[model samples]
Target: MAEQASPEAKYQLGTPENKQFLDEQRESLMAFGHRFPSPGGSSYWLGDDGTPWTDRNRETWITCRMTHVYSLGVLVGHPGAAELVDAGLKGLRGELHDDANGGWYPAVTPTGDYTPDKQAYAHAFVLLAASSATLIGRPGAQELLDDAEEIFLKYFWDAHEGLSVDTWNTEFTELDPYRGLNANMHSVEAFLAVADVTGDEGWRDRAGRIIAHVTKWASENEWRIPEHFTSDWKPALEFNRDKPDDQFKPYGATPGHGIEWARLITQYALSAKIDEAEKQRLVDIAEHLFARAVADGWNADGAPGIVYTTDWEGKPVVHDRMHWTLAEAINTSSTLARVTGKDVYLNWYSTFLQYLDANVIDHKNGSWFHQLDCENKLMTTVWPGKSDLYHATQSMMIPLRDPSLSISVATKEG
Candidate 1:
């Protein structure tokens, strides 16, 4: 067993290391703004020297990504959040309108590459942010909303396969078109956000189509999503399979994606709540995920909560550190509680939240550790403690609303 941390240690002002994560972000964002220029920019940049910036970095690392901040806006309308809305909306618009290709590039790396994968992930953010902006009556968000819808509908949607791509192959030398649960799940999330934000009948109709595609995939595949597929939705055989044989299952069989599928189905359920038949459809998906996750990979006392993969019959294997899975579990379970009016989801969420607060949260740092054993113990790793980007990067969004937990106690990231 590992040494237990005191509540004060766990709950007090977090490690100084955590503060540096955001400081680096704040400072780098500051630097990125002035040194790099883009076709469009927002006002949130500070410099590497922490100076004020006049230029744009298209990515707008700190400001646009302030999911925590945006969550803050959602939960309490924090002062900083209210101040940044216009700027955030503008950045979302610029990102959407970017490139002649009809979708936005991912971001500006240090070398200042546009890196236009035109990913569904960032576009998902576009949906969420635009929705939030519209909620607050921000002026420019409507056009951004239109831009997001157009790109998703025209560029990424694959009618035959019934899924969306993580990104396009246009920029790469060899054409390697791909679709994955991660991207398409994000597309589902984006559509849901837009539908809720606009409250338009058309948005809801579109959201239903996307959700149905996702549900069809999950329904046919044991409530698990494959990691990669061709544009037409055939599995990408022998592509990313060198790890461990058992680990190859859900891809042929994997556990992490079950959590993601659950998360999407959870959102789809919540999005489909207004109509009785739609709500029933979503409920079926949610129950299937819960039942499937329980059957395939969950351990009542395991560290990962779910196994990474199973045989063709659905079994758990290769219990490891998967941040995305864990994050999805937390969010999906929590959302299920909210949507179903069932106390069970809340109870499950509370249990998961307690575990996370005790483990993965890295009160010593700003972000999360990637993995641990299935029993909630930390694992030593080259990628241990802090990661620049991952699904857990946004985990704090929900927890921040829990004041007694001290997520807002200012451990890391300013």
Candidate 2:
């Protein structure tokens, strides 16, 4: 068993050494923002060689993530950060926006034609991006937030089901029967940000509803929350069994998402200031989710890292280790420590940091490696290049916050 350190010594997340390391990491991440802006939107992919892949189409999800990240950059006073944020605003206002369809497109070609699908996964990020930008008082951000909220309420939200639907046609005429926890998971995250920025209790209530729904499902399913579902919210447990490594809709439970949900639910519970009983219930669910993810994900595959997905029985399905998984594990462990004052969470935090230091951070290349094989060597089957800064950046920043504030709000007030 790992020896426990005193809380004063174990809370190394706020130490100056970690702060300096995070600052350096932020600097490296901001360097990539300069290459993201294009005519269509933020480019969907960046080559590992640190160049934007112009051949790849622009995507709303990537654009929104960049917007949210650069808004943080602006909050932190990074040089040239405002330019990227403005570029993202321009894209949201111009090409990505569907003047006829009413919601943003999932992707647009470089020449500016919108993709056919409008997805909740991407739109949730739009809500998040707009929320962060509005908090920073960016021009047009309020309008964007208003529009995103309207679209969400009008099209995606299924109040009867207490969850958001997965996708719709470009004109919002056809709804896909497929429901997904992934989109709702992100919706909870976006709702929290909206609540923080707008002081909207409604958004927080919606987040709590989603959290309650998912937590119930997770508890009934042995903590391996199902990702896919039908129109009436029936679990589609075998939705992607043939494609076990699909990037978005993988076959089995995503441990990273389990951990991510754990962190978000804890944040929601704290920020909403629920009654002690409700708060404790949320915390208990979060602890169970995190514990299950760590046990099934970390090193279950004869390697010293978290696997991307796991079967219902807690066996590794996709043995590849994703950088985002460890990032969320680090974040949830840190938050659990801060919330519960538990030494075990602190010990897990230290262990995750060691794993990240040895396997994930690409000290030679700048940002962390996005994916690795079972043996922990760099591999790029699912994700090519450092396409996102949101997860890793928050992993470094979450430890320094009050746990109630979303990362954007926390950074602004820090």
All candidates: CA RMSD in angstroms?
8.4, 2.0
Which segments of candidate 1 are over 4 A away from where they belong?
Answer: 1-75, 83-102, 159-162, 170-176, 237-239, 243-256, 270-278, 300-318, 338-347, 373-414
Mind giving the per-residue lDDT tens digits that candidate 1 earns over 67-136? Answer: 3244334334344544456656655556434555565666654444565556666666666556556655
Q: Write the per-residue lDDT of candidate 2 for residues 121-168, one digit (tens) a residue.
A: 999999999999998888899999999999999998888777999999
TM-score of each: 0.67, 0.96
Strongest candidate by TM-score? 2
Compared with the true structure, all predictions reach lDDT values of 0.51, 0.86
Scanning candidate 2 in windows of ten residues, the lowest lDDT window is: 1-10
lDDT of 1: 0.51
Q: Kindly report the root-mean-square deviation of model 2 from the true structure over all alpha carbons.
A: 2.0
